[model samples]
Target: MPFIPHTEEEVQEMLVAIGAASIDELFDEIPENLKLTQLDAIPTALSEMEITQLMGKRSLQDGEPSCFIGAGAYDHHIPAAVWQLTTRGEFYTAYTPYQAEASQGTLQLLYEFQSMMVALTGMDASNASLYDGASALAEAVLMSVRANRKSKSKRVLMPRTVHPAYRRVVHNIVRNQQIELVEVAFDPKSGQTNLAVLEQYAGEDFAALVIPQPNFFGVLEDVDALTNWAHANGALAVGVVNPLALALLTPPGLWGEAGADICCGEGQPLGAPLASGGPYFGFLCCKIAQVRQMPGRIIGRTVDLDGKVGYSLTLQAREQHIRRSKATSNICTNQGLMVTAATIHMALLGSEGLERAAAASFQNTRHLVEVLTAIPGVEVMFEQPAFHERVVRLPAPAKGILRSLAAHNVLGGFDLSADYPELGNALLVCATEKRTEDEIAAYAQKLERVIQLQGGVTCGLVPKE
Candidate 1:
């Protein structure tokens, strides 16, 4: 139970080999003040049977509430088959397919993942995967800097409405890279990136401009205008997009239609569970010209001497493992298991099914928004078009309202006031395809009651009785 397998003699022998008299001697370098004098509050060891019963009792107390939260991670429907397939010994236990010959299955799945990403983003090439969306954006920014060797742009512009974590990741990656991170402000009225501000910073010295599709506020930005502005200034446009939103909204490749050079984003909604925050995958796709600068691994199809179709690691020389510091990024592992799960999920859904799922989410969210805004004290934050998420101005403090919603067994939306002070009393609500009509209606009704009971109007735009 405790995994204390070493006998006393074995432990004494190990200590002798290390020139230590006892285990405590190994910690002699640590100061006494920093050492714990007593054990933690956890209970003493129990029999396995007793531990199981205790754990079962605690687990029963933790109930799963219907959730509405989706700032970055979402609660979309994951197919049962996805779990069954991903847990298979081949896909689940395998690590990096370092040797291409021994890992044909892993390599082929990576290849399929690349193909799906290419189709989804409308890009010429795609990498196997990265850590997550934020890291993917960081890698894309670095790649742009590398690709523009002659131009030597030292500035990168991102909109304020991009995910806060992503913005932080960019800052962290660029700190020692001698690059200036410029965050452009968004339009308060439209909740989209301010193109005029973008124009001011979009010069030859600017490396790339990152914009989120259906930005953090869930307002869809004018991709065509943003891309044109970035390109006209000789900078690349990097799109941080929602994979599900790509179903109804145009894919980032369409942004390429608008002149985008690189497209990257989180693929969590594709099938990956929001297990806490992750085990998520970051996708990077770009035009052929920028392929060499792309971080992470890429698998390609080839033929053997017998002329049979074969798969092998194609873009080896571009990564850190092969090229060291000169490589595009230090990332080595491709998030193989997560990528495989997403690939399998996408394969099952296909293009048409994905589009339909996206449409359902959009419709459900819009319906909920309309119902919530109808209440006396609630107000829609922006008139801009959105996908499955929307921001609403709350009559009462967002925290209080969220607490009340929680009491009613709902996981409420993210409170924007936590990050954007200007958006005081604003809550960012999200609805996925998993939300039933009854659940949406009930949430809206509960929100209305909570605000009204707190001496706040239900619809902010309406006159008090």
Candidate 2:
């Protein structure tokens, strides 16, 4: 069927009503030079089966490469049951779940999700979900401003160690709001937040301090010291975290326990695929006092007339639909499906399973790091303990090294020099539970070979595969 809804006469009448002589007039705002002047080089139509086969073939090209890439998003294990249950028509097609009476299941799922996030983050309260990690951080910054009773200066202190894209999101969301963003630099030797430097910038004018747990370089920051510092300055401490790492590391709520006011993170590692970068969930959790300032919807458990349990959207004061300028945020959609999937995955794994997965990823990554650093020209960038990722300084240019590794069908880690110039020729490698020991060993061998090919030789050892 044609996608256009109007009949020819209806289209003509609509065009005439709009004072346009033809359909092309509707697109007059588009520059004439930019308009397509010729038909595409390929046929416009294909049989459904042909299209399917074509798509399948295109997808196969992705497998021709091995993926070792991780900056924020990771390739992790997803159980078959997660897909099977999520794909059902009842869950897959559902959205909003606005009609609480009709959306009990969805609301309950969101409630459970919120509950899980609260437990994972160690925060007093959690929202249903946000757009993704970056937006969540942005929202948390805004929430900090709202929580500061004495501050009108909308200044936020964010460390350079936080994900680069996340910092960009903060700029995008806060720029028009007249918020001032101050970037705190990391210690050159440690690759972690310089608390002394952060303290120098801390003041009454600042609304919040944003730090990433197991920051972009994969070094875990001292949350206790940082959170205390932020609080001492009367600023909220916001911890941007990786959800999977929470399985083994201290939860951000513990940061709250240490005095952080807000905690938020990317939930992508929790059963959400990279999907070429996103459509993942951003989770926000905070002290109960900041619930009114939270940016997204909240689902609460209630009771029915018969005294049975029920769930409904509650505490929606922050949403724009309810209050225009008074709204805490303009975000309306809750990222329902993605949040649901994460919630289901967490529930399926429970605490013990999640801990095991985290442990395996940690052990595997440590082993890989040991092997890679054994290469003469390669050195571990941060000797600090990491959760599932690490950074290595390469004797050769990182881009050249990555290209060489790619030739051998191994996707290399993110090159830090692309963003951190000081960390010259460094690559941030990540391994998850999904990576096998053989894969790790193969990666080390390939990296060694790539380094040697670049005319860089490792010290004190003969090459062995």
Could you tell me how far off, in angstroms, the CA of residue 160 lies in candidate 2 after the best superposition? Answer: 0.8
**Clashes in candidate 2: how many?**
6
Q: What does each candidate score in C-alpha RMSD?
A: 4.3, 4.8
Whose TM-score is greatest here?
Answer: 2
Q: Which portions of model 2 miss their true places by more than 4 Å?
A: 2-45, 202-204, 256-258, 458-465
For candidate 1, lDDT tens digit of each residue in 1-465? 277899888999999999999999999999989999878797788988998999899876656777888898888888899989999998889878877778999988889999998888888899998999998998888888877654577788878999988889888987788887888998888888887777676444788888799798889999988887777777788888998888777777777445568989999999999877889999999988999889898889998789988798887898787899788888887677888999999999998988988898888889888888888777799889998899988887799889888988898899888788898789999888889989988898888788778878634446434
lDDT of 2 at 3: 64
